[model samples]
Target: MTEPLHSGEVDRAEYDVERGKIREFARATFTTDPVHTDRNAAQAAGFTEVPATLTHTVVAGHQREQRKFVEMLGLALERVVVGSVKWTYLRPLSAGDHVVGTRRIVDDVQREGKRGGSMRVVTLETEYVDADGDPVVRLEEVLIERGEQR
Candidate 1:
């Protein structure tokens, strides 16, 4: 049997934003807001560069880190379901910005179900800071699934 995942902080991961990545995310999320996709539109909008929404930053940074965390735990990705996600933005993230992500396991609990099953809910909180060390966003994600199924 595989060991249970240890609850702790994961190593921080950093990514330098690429123009292509920003454009792709914006397009994929259906964010047609010119300030997010077009450089000229962004400048016209009073931004020196395209600005990404909080959701964009969260998705790009958190998703990769979460997958790595699952791998570190030797857990199957398909066995887990995202129960909830919340993001709080402290500052705007521009297209050319670089971000560092720190993820920590905030809570873990196991419960027995009336149907003779057991489940675990794990809560993880991640903070994203810009190159200047200013916090840009904070995200909380909850994953839940049957304990033994994974």
Candidate 2:
């Protein structure tokens, strides 16, 4: 049996934003913005370095925490449904920024499913802070899990 998940800190991970990674992510996401790939372009735009694509932090290292959270909740992959995802960027993320993200379960709710079994709504929020301890980004995900039908 898996332990019950509470509204608390899950884990923390550090990611080093690399320029190569930024370019690769940009290409993968079909982002043709030169600011994401060329430091010269970014500098011309008044940025000190290449800025990551808007959604870069989503792939920075948050998925590991999400997987761990899912395991802690005793959720099977097949039964886990991602209801929504939201991202909040407090500052521009650029290559060479060392970011530390603290993942936490901010909210958990249990309710009886209208169709059959019980339902659980869990919200996981991760806050990424830079080396100076300034908040850089926040990622939130809502997951809905339903129990086996009776």
Candidate 3:
């Protein structure tokens, strides 16, 4: 049997920020703040450049980056389901900032079920930081894996 993914090692991925992404998101999400849509306004507001709104963190923190763990555990991608995505913003994620996400499996547990047979509950966390090492946001995601019978 293949062992589950344990916590310790970290996976890192660099994300590039695009101006249009933030602008389009802001327009769609009804963010009235020009700081998100205009570079000049963001600079005047003391940010290095135009910054994305709160919800935009989702793009930078997607679970696709956690595939390393899924592969390590020899788990089939089809069986894994995303349980939740909780984001804690430490600071603003700006457009000009070079960002990187450091991902890790924070929690793992197994339980027996009457109907489903067995289940594994895993919690993964990805912390985003700027090139200067400033904390941007922390993304906590949960993934549930079930037994073959179910």
Number of the top-ranking candidate, with lDDT as the measure: 2
Q: Measure candidate 3: CA RMSD.
A: 3.8
RMSD (Cα, Å) for all candidates, in order, is 4.1, 3.5, 3.8
Range of the 10 consecutive residues with the lowest summed lDDT in candidate 2: 1-10
- Give me the overall lDDT of model 3: 0.77
- lDDT against the true structure, per candidate, is 0.76, 0.83, 0.77
Q: Which window of 10 residues has the lowest lDDT sum in candidate 1?
A: 57-66
Better of 1 and 2 by lDDT: 2
Q: How accurate is candidate 2 locally (lDDT)?
A: 0.83
Between candidates 2 and 3, which one is better according to TM-score? Answer: 2
The parts of candidate 3 lying over 4 Å away from their true place are 1-5, 27-34, 40-48, 58-69, 114-116
The order by descending TM-score is 2, 1, 3
**Clashing residue pairs for model 2:** none
Give a tens-digit lDDT track for model 3, residues 3-121.
54478645776776778889988988999999998888898999988988877766653535557657875667887888888989898787766788888878777767667577787
Q: Work out the TM-score per prediction.
A: 0.79, 0.86, 0.75
For model 1, the superposed segments whose C-alpha errors exceed 4 Å read 1-5, 58-68, 74-76, 114-116, 148-150
